[model samples]
Target chain A: MKKKLYDLAHSRAGDKGNTLILSLIPYDEADYPLLCEKVTPDAVKHHLKEIVLGEIIRYEMPNLASLQFVCHQALLGGVTTSLSMDTHGKSLSYAFLQMEIEV
Target chain B: MIRIGSGAGFSGDRLEPAVILAEKGELDYLVLECLAERTIALAQQRKNRDPNSGYDPLLEKRIDLLLPILKEKKIRLITNMGAANPIGAAKKIMEMAKRKGIHIKVAAVTGDDVLEHLDGQQEVLETGKPLSKLSNLLSANAYIGADALLPALESDAEIIIAGRVADPSLFLAPMIYHYGWSVDDLDKIAQGTVVGHLLECAGQLTGGYFADPRKKEVPDLARLGFPFADVGPDGTAVIGKVEGTGGFINLATVKEQLLYEATDPTGYLTPDITADFTTVRLREIGSNQVEVSGGRGRPKPATLKVSLGYHTGYVGEGEISYAGPNAYSRAVLAGEIIQERLKDQFPDLRIDHIGVSSVHRTYFGELREPYEIRLRVAANATDSENAAIIGEEVEALYTNGPAGGGGARKYVREVIGIVSTLIPREKVQTQISIQEC
Candidate 1:
């Protein structure tokens, strides 16, 4: 069955220069491996393809049951330069939650 | 164990929460992490206009309110509220102390401002753009680390003021000073950095920004308590909030903040140490209590990160709301009309339907007929007049375009864009000076 990523996990996004770091943490420790299998860099890259301009890199920490996706060239130019109201890309974290995953 | 409480997370974090901590947390040091991108630039500009007014705007109010409570509680303060002018901020605090007929020692950490030494030689990290390209550069500050702040901890300064130190370093410096930990203690420093990062956001680890209704179920969010750390000699700390205060402190909140703004879990770079949060563990020892351990660290970077601010022209934005049936269509029509009118003048104008496509513009998912929608048009340009034209075009939509378009708002402002680069550590010098009260 298809389930929204938000149903299984919670994430937070923060900006650095022009990159957006989205950290995904599963609610259930048992579901961590499932997230590892389903939420690939390619999946996230394709999921946020509209705004992501550069490459996406994922760093996994099974110890913490969390994954961090570094999305480069994601912000218009980031807080100091971006014209977006959400210049820090604070709202972009939810964009990852929109991903559909089979649980 | 030395208790360190975060009084203010950002420049504008609520003060009431910090008051709660001062009265109850039994903190040895209350660190306030302020100053974010271009904040120093704005502070520098203010100082240029008036010599005495370059620090955090709320510095006086914060000091005035927290002085009696924190002083009686013996909770010394260390803050980056100096923004662009540390010495000036220190002097102002001293003056405030004098007026209140109180005796206090204030120290200012200076030399982070390296605008004069930039020489336009460094390249911006984002665009590989040279610093010489900016004609109207305002301020440039090197992110000095925990070492610069050591003298303040050593001295008898009741309040320490600093400008542009790395945010995490504010919390780490006091930890290093209190624990008598050597600068070379990478592992301990790493652990200290972890605590700093966790508490640096103030309430994030305690649930100020984490509530999502049924998804997260944070209680008493209205009175969300700020975070404090109970650090042991080895730098292991338990992160929690005050008793009977609002907000939840748990593993989920910690995990969320753990990776917040993190580039690499194993190599989260800071001026003091490169911390590894990969092995960090969180345990709920009690209600509103989570012990954090296992954070490791490595040697510091050879160079320091510099935040450079320059004039980036102007930005103009306009928003008009549409409600009732067909709100989305009317909002879309308003957006199209504004774009069509201003496309020639402001070729880079962006139009977004607030409810339909403001953020994450890609996936609108079937349009679901929002009861209300706001059409926003924004553009950036080299001149304020050109930017203002973008908003003017949008405001004209009130009578010329979509029906039921109300609540029009338009604004044009100067843009202070920030660029970052690396500077050799030896090029900058840091110092701490005590204000004669």
Candidate 2:
């Protein structure tokens, strides 16, 4: 079955310089393994191809059932210089949650 | 156990929540983490214009509202609202106390401003270019840690103000002081840092930013209460908010805040300690109460991170709304016209269909044509005059192109760019000056 990542996880995005840090956590601990296998850095890079212009590095926190994606050069230069309406990219988390994952 | 409440998270956070915490919450301290990345830089710019005006504009207003309650409650106040001018802010507070006939002791922690220490030859962490390469540099301040704030805390000052102190440090300094924890205790400092990181954002732990309607509902967001941590001697704490106030604190809220801006889970670096978030534990003990413990840490960094703000250039923006049938297409046409008209002058123009895809640059799921679409055109230029042209051209679209282009608005403003560098810890000096009224 195909299910959206939003069904399994919730996310919040924060920015430092030109990098966007997006934290992904599963609602159920049992779903952690599934997300870990499916939501690879390459997969996320492909998912937000247009939005992120740099590398995406994923850091896992097994204790918290969370995955942190550090997307570099992603804020379109960053909050101070970015011309985007959402300069902080606060809404990018929702965009990441909308990704389709196989269940 | 000592309770500490977060008054304000950012420079422009809601004031009422902090007031509620000061009045009702039984807290030993109230800390407001107001300095953001570019905040002090802008403050420095203001200081350059007028020496006494660089402090947080709301410092006076915030102190005015909370002073009486804080005094009655005997809650020691700590804040980084002293951005670019800790002494000036402290003086203002003392003056306010004298005028109001309130007895209070205010201490200003200075020396975070390391502008003179930088020769501009150092490399900028973001661009990897020599700092000298950047022109019109405005400010440079190091992210001082908990240790720098210890002097003021030890002085027993009722209010402590500082500039460019790391966000978590504002919360951790209180713990170190009250617990009498040694600065060398990396594990204890790390745990305190965790509490600081979580509570520094104020309402975030109590659900100010974490609402999603039916998916994740937060109650009474309008009256969302700020959070406080009850810290024990061991550095473990229970996070809670005032009862009967809006917003709920639970495992979910605590979990979200645990890694708010923590880039690395294992190696979240602050000047006091390199905190390891993976070691932390979160459990819901009761309604709106979560027990947080098990945070560990490694040794502190050898150098402090400095945020440098410089003149980037100018940004010109314009927005116009199109309505009724074929609004999306008409909005797209209006954007195309602006792009074609200003391509040579402003080559890097950005056009956004606000209603459809302004945020993420693309829409998710099925796309439905919005009845009302707002067309936004923005671009950056070397000078304000060139930037103004971007908006001027969009304003001309009212009659020059597109049908029903109503509610057009334009803006042009200077942009400040922030970058980071590192300075040896020994090179930065901190001092404390106390004033009583």
Error of 1 at A71 (Å): 0.5
**What would the DockQ be for model 2?**
0.79
Q: Give the alpha carbon lDDT tens digit for every residue of B1-437 in model 2.
A: 99999989999999888999999998999999899988998999999999888999899889999999999999999999999999999999989999999999999999999999999888999888999998988999999998899999999899999999999999999899888999998889999999999998999999988999988899999999999999999889999999999999987788888878887878999989999999898888889999888889899999899999999899999999999999999999999898888888887889999899999988877889898999999999999998999888989999998889999999999999998999999889999999997
Each model's TM-score? 0.98, 0.99
Error of 2 at B336 (Å): 1.2
For residues A69-101, write the lDDT of model 2, one tens digit per residue. Answer: 999889888999899999999999999998998
Residue B307 C-alpha lDDT in model 1: 90
Error of 1 at B185 (Å): 1.1
lDDT of 2 at B197: 93
What is the lDDT, from 0 to 100, of the residue B129 in candidate 1? 82
Off by over 4 Å in 2: none
Model 1, residue pairs in steric clash: none
TM-score of 2: 0.99
Q: Give DockQ for candidates 1 onward, in order.
A: 0.79, 0.79
Residue B234 in candidate 2, Cα distance off native in Å = 1.4
lDDT score, candidate 1, position A78 = 83
